[model samples]
Target: MEVYLVRHTETVCEKGICYGQSDVPIAAPYLEIFESIKKQLPQDAIVYSSPLVRCSQLASYLSNTIIKDDRLMEMNFGNWEMKNWDAISPDEFTPWMNDFVNVSVPNGESFVELYNRVNDFLENDFQHNTSKAVVIVAHAGVIRSILCKISGLPLKDAFNNKVGFGAVIKIVL
Candidate 1:
């Protein structure tokens, strides 16, 4: 299967805000951006998206029937959600900063947990699907996790994939 992992476009939130799983909307002037992204994808592929509005909006525009899955959500930042990163207490993120791959945020999940859940979706839902091509509209973290899983990268180095907003990455499974 050819799976295209597409990150949602920029959000309305300003930089440094931790908006994970917060259902933020896409930035303004998204129509042109969405159009460009649409040009890169297969027109008749099975499409999946996070329930978050940012991703759902893009998915809705790209596919007539988009499958909204909770598994595709960005990592839940827990107490950090919707807070500016600089405003957050440094002490609060110290442990997670030290070992984010293994450490769960306060009331949130670890990268391991996100990886596992995404893996479950891939294993059970995606793998069993019959479509020759699939499109996944989700967050950077989810796209990075999928890239790491498919490319044999360590969770700690997931950032290396550089999943820019509205970017499309196609991988075969």
Candidate 2:
């Protein structure tokens, strides 16, 4: 199977904001970008997306019937929702910084947790689907987790991967 993993377009949130799993809007005039990415997709690809508007907007361009999946959502940040990364106290982020390779956020999910969800999705697709190509519209964290799964990279390296708005990574499984 061929998979096209796509990150959502630029969001309304400003830079440095921690927006995982947050329901945020995409910036206006993103139609051009969406159309451009849509053109790159295989015509018969099944499109799936996180329920968040940021991802939904982009997914809608490729297919009106976007399969919304909670499993594809970003890692939940809970109380850290909408807060800037710098605004979080060092104590709040320090533990994660040190142990995020395994540790989860308070009242939230971890990279490993997100990976399990993504893996389940992959398993279902890999086992039951016959489509030669599929498109997944998701968050940077979700995309990173899948890439880590495919590349055998550690969660710490997920922080260093750059998955930009409208970027698409192809994987053959």
Question: What is each predicted model's overall lDDT from 0 to 1?
Answer: 0.91, 0.85
Off by over 4 Å in 1: 127-131
What TM-score does prediction 2 earn? 0.93
Candidate 1 — which pairs collide?
none
Q: Identify the leading candidate in terms of lDDT.
A: 1
* Model 2 lDDT tens row, 52-104: 98988788888867789888999898778899999888887998888776778
lDDT of 1 by residue, 40-129 (tens): 999998999999999999999999999989999999999999998888787888888889999998899999999999998998887455
Error of 1 at 7 (Å): 0.5
Off by over 4 Å in 2: 125-128
The clash count for each model shown is: 0, 0
User: For every model shown, what is its TM-score relative to the native structure?
Assistant: 0.97, 0.93
